[model samples]
Target: MRIKVSLYARRGEVLDYNHCYELAREIRRAIKTVDPEILSDEASRLYTFSRIMVKNRSFELCRDGMKLLTSQLYFFFSSLSKNICDSLIDGFVELRRLNAGGISFEVSKIEVIKESKITGNEKLVTLSPINFRDRSCEDADFEEKFTEKLTKELIRRYTIIYGSNFDGDVRFKVLKCKSVAIRVGGKKYRAHLMVFNAHGSKKLIEIGYKSGFGTMTDCGFGMVKKAKRI
Candidate 1:
């Protein structure tokens, strides 16, 4: 399931560039408040079953800093749990104040992506930027390492969610990767916006879609959506 949230801020609100981490924390807080069990130590050890993405964000340059315009936030879940979904929606709506990178905003709208609207084919997928490591690796070795790491992560998350290990042929080749720097929780990390060709089961692909592809997904790092073509 996918959930989209609309946020609005007053004019002249300054927001830092790397605010996804903070935004993710707020979302988690809302989920935890509604049901603390979701964040228990045991659960923490398990694979993250959700992913977050920011959309329609706009920033303005100012002498002081960059100012941000209101935008939409997306959340993807692996399971269709009513309790989890309801808690997220209710908690977020009740707690209207949200702060991202120290900038405050109001939650204006919350909408669920129904089955009809959820479009994606799991077999062939395209991931947005996936922050796999904190520092850069050899350009030649990056693709191999990325594919291995992602395959392992998918297996882990698949076991946690489905109660079985996936033993399928997982293969990928990097179509393109653009080097970039990402700041989250006041720390900077080297990352990439990579397009890859993945050959895997539908379940594994779905896991990547819902739970994110690489590391730091919970901090909003590796969220992915279906791409018709790379």
Candidate 2:
């Protein structure tokens, strides 16, 4: 079966879509410019995907609606000033805040994600190493020795990719699946393995960290499971 991929905008049969689509495009651009730092730092904001999605569909007639919706959404960063970077950070923080506050779904399990790819420098790292010590017919003249060297390169390359954000055309899978969470100060935290309903596409994510202490992932969802929402 062939898959059809078309970017969706508020076009086609939708009238008065220019404003909505323009807003939507801008929001997406802003998010793309902000999420990397926001995700890595694990911050919090006073926003929600529903709100963002709504604003992205803003209109002149619905101007009041947009403002009302956004007003409830706080800039969950350190301050209320709006910048592209700040907006993304705030959005990221807000998403986590809801998830931690029992304002979202109750995820009972997750699968740790893994990604591995051999390209560029990593490919060089996976090559046959230059024999140095003794160029004899015993130590460096066997297929096993070559295989071992290749394996070592593969390990090093994977290690670097896992830690750094240098993923180039790399794909992911469930890596040694587990059902546990992590903690930093005194709260519980875990990354979400987000799977969209469309095609079951997934990405390992750690959205929430902590609450009342300015977005963090240290606090687990178990603490905010409705029974503790106050």
lDDT of each: 0.61, 0.23
Give the alpha carbon lDDT tens digit for every residue of 1-230 in model 1.
55666666655666555666777788778777777887564224222322233455455666544665435444443333455666778888889767875567778788887532232233333233577773354467777788788888878777777778778646777766677677776687777766666676666766666656776666666665555552
Worst 10 residues of 1 by lDDT: 42-51
Pairs in steric clash, model 1:
none
Q: Among all windows of ten consecutive residues in candidate 2, which has the lowest summed lDDT? A: 205-214
Best by lDDT: 1
lDDT (tens digit, per residue) of candidate 2 on 41-132: 32222112211122244323342222222212111111111343345444433432222211221122112112232122111110011221
Best by TM-score: 1
**Could you give the C-alpha RMSD of every candidate to the true structure, in order shown?**
4.0, 20.9
Regions of model 2 farther than 4 Å from truth: 1-29, 45-47, 51-85, 88-230
Candidate 1's C-alpha lDDT? 0.61
For model 1, the superposed segments whose C-alpha errors exceed 4 Å read 41-58, 61-66, 69-82, 115-128, 134-138
Residue 49 miss distance in model 2 (angstroms): 4.0
Per-prediction TM-score, please?
A: 0.78, 0.16
